[model samples]
Structures are given as structure tokens and as C-alpha cells.
Target: MAKGDILKAALSNPNRGPHQTALIRSAIYKEMEQFTATRRLPPSLDASEICRILAPIDRHLTPDDYDRLHKFSDFLAVIDTSPNAHPGYHLLGEKLSADLGL
Candidate 1:
């Protein structure tokens, strides 16, 4: 499946609750780790696609999910620091912040 599709599928059940959410997050983290293994960053378009797909589930993410994303993706680190770097970054950052009250 495509990256965005994978995320969408994982997040399809919005009311699945926290345990399922955590499992989904772990799967996403593992996929991201594999995807980023040889690259320092995802292309901007790819990141945007992923962020957009993840927007709906941003509220479902645990703090540990955010931590794992930060640890794995330099792309996310850059996005977190400079949200204006791309529309995707801004959208994702805003969603995360609003969802988590961070």
C-alpha cells in the first residue's frame, strides 16, 4: 500500500480507542524507521502527504508516539522547528498542538 493509504487505513476507525491507537502508532513508527533508514529526510511532498493523511488521527496520538516520531524522522524535527517550511508541516504541527494542547 502507498504511504498515505497505509496511514489512512490505520486511522480509519477514529473511535477505536487508545490501545488500538498505540498499536497503530507503533506500526507507523516502525514503517517510518524503515523508510528513513537510508535517507536523512523525506521529500517535502512526501512529508506533506503523510501529514495530511495523519491529520485526522493527530488527536489519537500519544506523547510517546510524538517522541518516537521525533527520534526517527529528521524531517519531523525540521518541521517541528520550522512549521512554515511547508504547508504540510504547518498543518500537521497545528493539528498536533491543538490535539495535545502543546
Candidate 2:
């Protein structure tokens, strides 16, 4: 999916289901053991780094929603690995949260 589409969908839907929200929340809160993976200043981590399954969201999420989440995952992957995350990270995150109602 195109990056823009995913971001748009994320903005469209911020309300998330309980199960999906829980899964995301866990990712948001969980600590990683590979803190040194960055080999530099401590960096943040994403859901994919911790592990992920869209099954919880696939139940009712739209393709756009999936795309949005996928994009968010990609964003997390970057920020989690490096300190210089995309400027849109927070925007995309807000969109995803709103879209999933997180």
C-alpha cells in the first residue's frame, strides 16, 4: 500500500476495538532487551520489533485500516532503530490511534 493511503486511513479511524487496542498497548508499553541494538544513544522500539499479529484487528478493520497500521509499523521500525525518526511519526501515530480508537 502507498504510504499516504495508510496515513490517511489511520487518520480516518482512531477508535480501536478492545482486543486490537490491548495488543497495541502492550507494544507501546513493553520494554525491549536489545537496547544496544542501535549501537548508539538509546532508541525507541516498535511493535514489529517486539512481535505482532493483526488477527486481533482483522476481524473488523478495513483494508485502509490495515494499511494505516502497516505504515505505522514501518514508522515504528525506523524510530525504534534510530533516534532520527520521521517527522510524521507523531502525526501518523495520532491518526492510527484515532482510527483504532486507541
Model 2 Cα lDDT, one tens digit per residue, 1-102: 322333334334567665554555354333222222343221333434222333243355556645545654455455555576552443445546655768
Q: How close is candidate 1 to the true structure, as a TM-score?
A: 0.34
Task: Work out how many backbone clashes candidate 1 has.
Answer: 0
After superposition on all CA atoms, what RMSD does each candidate show versus the true structure? Answer: 10.7, 10.5
Clashing pairs in 1: none
> What lDDT would each prediction earn against the true structure?
0.46, 0.43
lDDT of 2: 0.43
lDDT of 1 at 80: 37
Q: Could you tell me how far off, in angstroms, the CA of residue 17 lies in candidate 1 after the best superposition?
A: 2.1
lDDT of 1 by residue, 1-102 (tens): 433234444545456566556555555564554453223333442433444344235576655544434332334334334544332454456555655768
Best by TM-score: 1
